[model samples]
Target: MVKAAAVVIVVVGALGYYVWDYNTSPTGGKAKSEASASAAAEEAKTHDPEVGDCVKVADPQGEPLPTVVDCNSPQAEYKMGEMLPGTQLECASQYDYGIQYHNSRGFDYTLCFTKV
Candidate 1:
């Protein structure tokens, strides 16, 4: 009988904690769910990191090297190098996103990345 009482008390304490936490947390609000989902959708729509998007490569060697194969703009060509992906790329930090060249460009000129 005493063990049963202890178990009941423990369960009741856990339930009370859950109720208190749910009411106090910011995530408890129904408004945050809709806002979170909308923010997620907007983030998904905006984050399009694709190839052929006019970029300047920021290599460890720094700045554009001499051989830029695909860029039509001299400015874009002037910013090419062996740049890998997910390295915070931009033509410069202030401008829009630069193209992320896939790292498969061998001697024959191709782009490659390990697919997740």
Candidate 2:
């Protein structure tokens, strides 16, 4: 009986230590990692490609995230042409592609690009 009680106590103590260590970690556990990821996504969403700038579209569906790149690079698939004040539907006929960004905070813009 004493052995069983000692084993249970040790197990519980070890588990409690693990929980404390995880919660007190410098990175603040999974919550901090998730917040960092969210911050990164927000930053990516704000990347505005200027006219004539070469960009690489990371995702063409949903909210498109385009990264500016050197025009000569292979990943440079599109060259920005015009920046409209509205959605993708407002793209000019001369532009081959358009990526629109609409946020709840009143920032709405579109980036028109030509396939390279």
Candidate 3:
């Protein structure tokens, strides 16, 4: 009976120590790591192309430009962000480019690359 009691005590003590150690760890509990990773992943989603970011579009003018989106009006083409790497851009003549559009993703320099 004494031996069994001693074994149980030791096991319980070890378990308690392990729990304490885990909580005291710099990284903290499972919740912290998961939350941090989730937050980082979310931040990564906001990535926009940079100045040297390239992309592939249907640019007939061979005007190597950055990739982007459209979140502007018809006249003012505000710069958004950037595109991917090595993108082919098409002229406004073919794609009917009017205004350079810059959305949250990136900037499209179609302001003066249109035909009409």
Model 1 regions more than 4 Å off? 27-38, 47-116
Candidate with the greatest lDDT versus the true structure: 2
What TM-score, over all chains together, does every model reach? 0.28, 0.57, 0.34
Give the number of colliding residue pairs in candidate 1: 1
Q: How accurate is candidate 3 locally (lDDT)?
A: 0.46
Q: Kindly indicate the candidate among 2 and 3 with the higher TM-score.
A: 2
Ranking by lDDT: 2, 3, 1
Note the residue pairs that clash in candidate 1.
104-112
Our tally of clashes for model 3 stands at 15
lDDT string for model 2 (59-88, tens) is: 788667888888999989899998878664
lDDT tens digits by residue: candidate 3, 1-116: 99999999999999998888677776668657778899998654433333322222334255434333343424322342332222234333333332244556764333323221
The number of the candidate with the highest TM-score is 2
lDDT of 1: 0.45
The lowest-lDDT stretch of 10 consecutive residues in candidate 1 is 107-116
- Indicate the TM-score of model 1: 0.28
